[model samples]
Target: MEQKVFIKYFSGTMSRGTRGIVFLLAIALLAICAQNTQARVTLENGVKSKVYLSPKIALHQGSVANKYYYDMEFPKGHIAIKSFNAEVVDEEGNPVSLKETYLHHWVAARYYQRKGIKEPKHYGNLGFQQSDHIPAGNAGVCNSASGLSQFFGLGSETRKTSTHVPDPYGIEVGNPLEIPSGYEEKWLLNVHAIDTRGVVDAMGCTECRCSLYNVTVDEYGQPFKPNYAGGLYCCYDETQCKVKNGLESVKRNVYMKYTVTWVDWSESIIPVKIYIFDVTDSWQYTGIHDCLIEFDVEQSTTNECMDTRRSKSSFPIAGDVVYGVAHLHSGGIGSALYGEDGRVICSSRAIYGEGNEAGDESGYIVGMTTCYPKPGSIKIANGEVLTLESNYSSQKSHIGVMGLFYILVAESSTTLGSPVQIHQESKVPIFFWGVAAFGLAIFAAIVVAYRRRRQNGDGYHSIAT
Candidate 1:
């Protein structure tokens, strides 16, 4: 409980507006720490995972792991946070082990800081900070198991074994998953819960279960056509411009699933939370017939994007359809074309094949969600939302990137119908239509009066002559 409070409070200060998902992360970390210090969580698999002290702080779980799952850009060839489990499981369900001594360590995969059109063409490096063994075994694997142990940096034996990985768990796609400043896509997230590394390594129930969440960003960094007039779009090349350009930060949910389990513990449980965000205008097209003109949202509603990088949605539109692309971190895998009523019509997953690794595509936006329009309804009515979900998180998925997108669900009212052209001529307002109608009527009456007067005058002139 105290840990949760600490994170929430700290997050309030550290996070900038709701924009700081780091606040949520801080909350999660606090919960994690609390679970380690003062609580017990029991699971269905008979493995009881918990924090060991006062007031039992944190959600119960033999399931649900959110903090573990991450959705970030993964550089090509990098081995990242696949999965991690922390729990103590003897043959019997026991939250507390009378004779087990524990040691914990924190491990992370670090990437090289380099700039490129997409994610780097290579994987980065990883290292584990170690810890000294626990001096006392009086309490449950609460604070000690989850927090103290890891912060000290204990190393693992499984991490050393590269030759014999019995089960391959992770979305292993080729190339790198990219997410620059403006890249945007619907995002999903998850976290893994690990309590006892020893038992997880021993039991071989290595596949971990996790929690999920969601997030929505304003836009993908793929710049729109340069506005030579304002010089705002030119910042893509300058790199030094101070103008803010990362899309609107909008996190809405978080999801959970499983990753890796080289631990030896019995089946365990975990509790986690999730967060997700959306980029409201993500559905627009960028480059096809022309770059400036956006393909109608109506087309996007019906035809899902095929071949995200090399392909597009040809909605049988009037003009040639153009293309616009976006990206998100790893946790954004399950993104798809959902209807206004929340019915998913087409999806990026189906086009790319469900659960395809984000790192597989060479040209697709990095960390991008692979979604498409559903078959039945491609067009969206007002008040509809696209839920991008999937891919549990890990340390590897945390590098900041872009997020969820929208395709002009509705534009600003003041700037509404003003465009290059309209459905027929111009989008004159309702009042404009009324005024034009009145003017036409007055002009017609004047013309009628002139014709009658002229006819009378002609008759009189003829009689006088």
Candidate 2:
């Protein structure tokens, strides 16, 4: 006869109170771990993981007169770029635009990568201050709201998911667009002319002060030796800037350049993507007028002459916001992001240069540094309304000003949830503790109920049996 085998069964179920306690503690532990994790997630091995790209070029006066090109040449290797950015600067190294130079057109195109892809085509537009259907790749000279005319250059910031202030000129990377090996890429710059001399002459006010004329530049797009004026005036009047005056000077020898930043893959690292948010999409912006507007907030005056209107637009994606910066012309105060519920997610303050330095003229703004505070992560649901708000000085109207904000967004790997008030308070830990306490309370209630039933005699004893 065949030998028989016996097996034991675990029929006892865990008490509801025990289950609740375990679940709560697990959640609390997971939530804490999420905070320590990085914004990027995962990288492959055997590849050059310690990769970063710092491509920079100088735009001389003669070269930028029409369209100048930078044929990006990389050394022999298996290289790729995950992010790219560009900026323009003056000869003095301060963030500034050439007096008459308004970037007419700019394109970063790639040579054919695959056989069927046709001739070299533009992968992105790196022009100054454009928020069209196409993504923005250019980080114009000294993107700030303080109205300081200078180049603050580029800087790198720590990657974070919390809601903190951002530096506009800070060297930050955006969504990854790779330029694989054997593929050629180039940047083209095209600028037009706006005559400040004519604008001042049309004003015909010997006593009237204008920014465009006060900050004067020579035919070579070089500023005068002594620029006593508070601002750079490229045109004498608004009409000259518009309508494309044939008399305006286009041939100016000025210095401009583009700065590109990205992460090089040499080691394993978490991967993140970038997304853009623009305020020009709203009805408030009319292509009929310049992308930059001048406005007087104190007088509440808004017209073609004064741009007292606030720029507001919706954020496109629903993810944890990792990094961000605001792009504004002179006379800006700060930029903020608001939720559909009217809650402010993160506010980036604009920093201005001071002490009457070359770039930091008295009250003029030179740079706007960004912030990346820890613990406070901001998350928005898909299709949620995230408005970009830029505030500027209202004492006087400004011209050729801009208000654009860009951010990096990442997908969360866990459901630990997002944290709020990290800038002011560390709420993640507190939140976990609170959840755990609630779970403990439930467990206690169950225990008390069971004990009461057990002490109740006949019916309780029968149930137990």
Candidate 3:
């Protein structure tokens, strides 16, 4: 009986030792798994980000620079773009205030240029008509010739806007299969800036009032209609706004400092198509989308002081909306996109600056709100009639105002799948998790065995006593 008790006690001690070792081994395995999970996630989500400066722009008091920079330095090779943000900066990389230099608008366009051909002297004129140049614009409902074909564009509100494409969805570009033979992909940047320092009317200059610039003809020397008061035509390159008499200001060089974020294209990444809607779209009347990019807001005639414009058009394709945002100029109150059943899909309001800093320049639009709907919640059916409504405070007449909506759509939600599926596809390698779970199972089994051995040892001691 004493020998039996000794054997039982020995077994209990061995079991306890085994349990402690198993517990430590389990903890160590979990730590290694956590490290492995992090490393795996870093590898799978290989998002690369970089900031680049555009070709230098020279400006002075009341001067304007509306230049198209072709073959601008950009990320090379096939990739999925995640976000693009830009701000005007001086030569020293300091952010420039909108009060000093108003950013009218900046457009980023994609194109294909045939190899062994000289680049066009001006992309705005040749556009897609030149034999050597092919405009690779967004999935559009607007006429490409109307200058609304850009994949990305923003006005003074660029600084505060959110352009990030969420996880698993991206803007796919630079695919070799899509590029035409003997042609290479290229990008174009159009920056229209107006220096308002010492100007007679800063807001008028920014609005491109023809009187402020003292111009009757456009950049191409084309005559403007007698009633055409102001717009982009009045604020072309080399044009100058009326300045204060004898007010001296030195010329300064500035650049559009742009940052791009993207990830290398992979099978797991779902591509999204970009579509831009214009409130001035006349599709129902013209049978073709004629997007008048700008319009004039006449002052109120009575007590009502709001100018509201609405346009309805059928969505050309069926897809799920991933993200949306509006591009509205100064004086814009808000804008909204509606579905066929009058459901509000998305709405964005302007955020005006109240200070004198670069992003917070007083009385200037610093940023606009954005929309990110659930993966499959907001779906646009093919041929679905959509309405766009834009409102502006009509306290006084304003020209060159814009109301545009941009949205990114995915073909289907299957690619994104359920949240659990997205996690499984993007990160959390099955093999590693399986190993961790196996380790836990073994640890649990050892615990149970230790408890049984202890109970048996206790019974044997009781009998011996």
**CA error at residue 283 for candidate 1, angstroms:** 17
Q: Predictions ranked by lDDT, top down?
A: 3, 2, 1
Q: Which candidate wins on lDDT?
A: 3
Task: Report the Cα lDDT for residue 202, model 1.
Answer: 13
Q: Where does candidate 1 stray beyond 4 Å?
A: 1-326, 330-332, 350-376, 385-392, 395-397, 406-465
Each prediction's RMSD to truth: 33.2, 22.6, 13.9
Which residue runs of candidate 2 sit more than 4 Å off their true CA positions?
Answer: 1-254, 257-263, 283-316, 355-358, 373-376, 413-465
Who is ahead in lDDT, 2 or 3? 3
Give the per-residue lDDT of model 2 (tens digit) for 85-128.
33334444444432323332222422223223343344222232
Q: Against the true structure, what is each candidate's TM-score?
A: 0.18, 0.43, 0.80
Ranking by TM-score: 3, 2, 1
Model 3's lDDT to the true fold? 0.86
Error of 1 at 220 (Å): 21
Q: What is the lDDT of residue 400 in candidate 2?
A: 40
Local distance difference test, each candidate? 0.25, 0.38, 0.86
Query: In candidate 3, residue 173 scores what lDDT?
Result: 93
Worst 10 residues of 2 by lDDT: 152-161
